[model samples]
Target: MAQGVFAITEQRDGELRKVSFEAVSEGRRVADGLGADLTAVVLGSGIEGLAEELKKYGPDKILVADDAALADYTTDAYTNVLAELIQSSDPAVIITGASAQGKDLSGRLAARLDAGLAMDCVEIKLDNGNLTYTRPMFGGKIVAKVEIEGSPQIVAIRPNVMDIVENSKEPAIEKPAVQVGDLKTKIIEMKMETGDKPELTEADIIVSGGRGTGGDYAAVEELANELGAAVGASRSAVDEGWRPHSDQVGQTGKTVSPNLYVACGISGAIQHLAGMSTSKYIVAINKDEEAPIFSKADFGIAGDLFEVLPAIIAEVKKLK
Candidate 1:
């Protein structure tokens, strides 16, 4: 019979992503519910030391595929090796983060394994030894509960939505040797995003600007600096050449669920809300009181962001 809850952990540049812990922790919960063991899979070159970190999240065992060819993330290499592992292990459920890498790998892996996949899941529940996933539909207007039939159900969970619980376990670590067949693609060069600010998906706090900034993000950046928050921009801001596409948070861009989201001069389009509506707390600043963002915000400031931002920055500075 198929058994074990398998959590696929993501790592980049030999460091585990924040979502890796969350996937393992959530897998632990499901394993407990289904009376199954939780196993975490980490693939990278020279990443044997990462087992110590995964053990803290309660995996009963960890399979480390330490391979030089698997160092960089490619679609073919990861899918081939992971498919072999899953076929041998026969896990009942497989979980991965909904980050860019995870999203890409899960679909390909599902097809290779002929498994059902639930993408961008926000909530996972165990129902009578089966798993049901809750995911947003139609651009966050509604949520749909999904269930996969058959063994080895695959799920990709959204980042920051799942809590990382520490359930220490003395997991048996195994270094597995697998053949990573010839790859279809090769990385010639990688252009990394350089910044001190936390990644938008993993950030605890974010301050975003919109078309209301009139193409000037000076005040928004200053406020973000004072609050120690990552700077984000709306789609309109990005289309206008005010900010790069990477900085945009919306349906067409990266989805973020920060602890605190401060919207400056944004009119809160539904597409924009689809990304960050799950933030723990929202603060919107716009001159228009009727702006759609205010309806979702915990606190709304009906004033010019230029004037309101400096005040917020000063107050934050005083607190610091």
Candidate 2:
């Protein structure tokens, strides 16, 4: 028999990611709907301090695994800790963010636990006390709702899709006994990408460029800096060597759901729209009025990005 809902809260460098809270919020909703308690699982070294912060999102219990072996993320170490926790708790449903780390962890955990896993879910709800998850399929052309046949249902939610609410609940912190007995992998070295702004997948506002900018990222970079937004690039721009593939936003790249998305010089391809069409507000800047991106944008500016971006940047600065 399964117990309740368990949400895996992801943390990096002793700081909790916003997606962690969003997962907790979603898990709580499902737990409430099913008349079950919500429990949060925080795994990593030096993360005991985050227990109080996780409680604010309304979990009934906070499970922390503090150990040196868990400091750096590896599939084997993380999967081992999470698998042990899930086996002991026997949760009816487990949820995690559909991030790079989440996707990797969830798959391995599911395999270890022999549980059905749903990936990249946009929405999760209980239909008459049964868990049903909705996700994009066939290249965002179709939406599919899935349900696990047995107990311990697992899901990985897409970032920025669900609303994260601070319910102000005081969660009881419980430290779980983590068995770190001889992991197969050893982390000898780790390198992290440095950036000033939030990650593109997690940013509230994102400003992106495309080939129409003529390989000069100055206009896009300036506007992004002024707005304190993450910079992104289209497939065309990335392929042209104007930007790195790490910043690419499209079907083949990162999917983002920012509060606002500003697309400059990018002709909106279906592949690109599949990634960021869920953004709350879209502003398109292009010289061609007939561009496909204009149709999806809430605000459209049919003009040269070089001319429009500078003025917009100036206006934004004045307002600030």
Candidate No. with top lDDT: 1
lDDT of 1: 0.93
Give me the displacement of residue 184 in model 1, in angstroms: 1.6
Candidate 1, residue 142: lDDT: 77
What's the TM-score of every candidate structure?
Answer: 0.97, 0.96
Q: Which lDDT tens digits does candidate 1 get at residues 1-320? A: 99999999999999999999999999999999999999999999999999999999999999999899999899999999999999999999999999999999999999988899999999998878767899987667678999999878999999988999999999999988988998889899989878678888888999999999999999999888877799999999999999999999988987888999999999999999988898899999999999999999999999999899999888998996
Off by over 4 Å in 1: none
For every model shown, the clashing-pair count is 0, 0
- Full-model lDDT, candidate 2: 0.89
RMSD in angstroms between candidate 2 and the native structure over all alpha carbons: 1.3
Clashing pairs in 2: none
